[model samples]
Target: MTEVFFYHLQKQSLEAVLPGLLEKAIERGWRVVVEAGSRERLEALDAHLWTYREDSFLPHGTAGDAQAALQPILLTTAPDNPYGAAVRFLVDGAPFASAEGYERLVVIFDGNDRDALAAARDAWKRAKAAGHDSTYWQQSERGRWERKA
Candidate 1:
């Protein structure tokens, strides 16, 4: 069964925390796929991943890229995983039909957005009912991620 993780963003924006999570996934030798709700969001994330910090670089590409399979991280609006990534990240309330093939599924939503929070809760319920091992993580006051439930 796939392990599902729900990250509720409160103290920081997605831009502030996503890169670090991607870096950790890379450190674990896991290829990743980040899916956004729209093309604009996917493009924004693609650009952000490249210039998020001055000293670091995350090698990534979009589904339209020719060598997408070579990228450790691939960004897309659709659910296709061209890189055969072990981990899949759904951002901006993007919905994933199933967790099949991926070792882990991560859902990141803004806590400040009532709609996003409601969607996350629904996803959590669905994942639990499907027998997936799930966990909820929230950002603390100091901008640290803490497991909540």
Candidate 2:
């Protein structure tokens, strides 16, 4: 069975680990969907990897066509694994809801950001209500990303 490990890491840790992770994923032929706040980080990984800015929206002038522009990128482009495998590395309280669409969701919380932690808790509630087996990890200033599980 294939397993997806969700890593909740700090920006610094992400920067250090991403290149190697991407390379390993490619080498293993594993599908990866990286959700992050920084466009630079995503672009740095590889041009072939699809990058999605969860907060980005189409221009107001194209409000009606916004869904058309965003939906394909958000939903269709990332291929699915029949073996139910995938990982999510969330940063700054992002990527915390309805993980049902994916096999597993790993939430990364920065210990320094109280506000982001609160937001992540709220999102955790929503995910639980939606029936996803989710978990969270805290990244310390010492650069360790620790999780309960």
Candidate 3:
């Protein structure tokens, strides 16, 4: 069974929640791969992980073609692209070829707007609908981190 883990980061920076998630993934002996549009952003969280490759750019267009060739199972980020932000890759299945290689899917959002929440909800629904077990971890209005319960 594919276990879906969702983590909602309510704080202003990814710092608040990313470390904990990376730690848990590491504890489980999972290899971590992070992709983001900004090098500075990925660096803020990369310090905690043991092994990570940084791509200051995102997966799109011709660049996206190269990323697909690489075939990374675990994609992590505070996505800046609208498509990435919407978690569209999970649905498209093109840029992200297969789900079989990944053990889990984790998305951490800043939760600044209702649309982001809606996107997260929709992504989870689609993943579940496709029978690819998924979950979301996000921050509540009160400013504490929690998973979808």
TM-scores for candidates 1 onward, in order = 0.97, 0.49, 0.54
Candidate 1 at 141: error in angstroms?
1.4
Residue 134 lDDT in model 3?
71
| Candidate 2 wrongly placed segments (more than 4 Å) | 1-12, 17-29, 38-41, 44-85, 92-97, 139-145
Per TM-score, what order, best first? 1, 3, 2
> What lDDT would candidate 2 get against the real structure?
0.45
The segments of candidate 3 whose C-alpha lies over 4 angstroms from its true place after superposition are: 37-40, 47-98, 138-147
lDDT of 3 by residue, 67-148 (tens): 5334222343433232222122221111222234456655555466575456666656766766887766556677676666
TM-score of 2: 0.49
lDDT for each residue of candidate 1 in 88-128, tens digit (9 for 90 to 100): 99998798578888899999999999999999999999999
Q: Write the per-residue lDDT of candidate 2 for residues 1-149, one digit (tens) a residue.
A: 11224455564545455545455544554444445545553344333333323443211111133443332122121233232335444543345545655544545455346886676667667766675665555456685656654
lDDT of each: 0.91, 0.45, 0.45
**Candidate 2 colliding pairs:** 8-108
**Regions more than 4 Å wrong, model 1:** none
Mark the 10 consecutive residues where model 2 has the least summed lDDT: 56-65
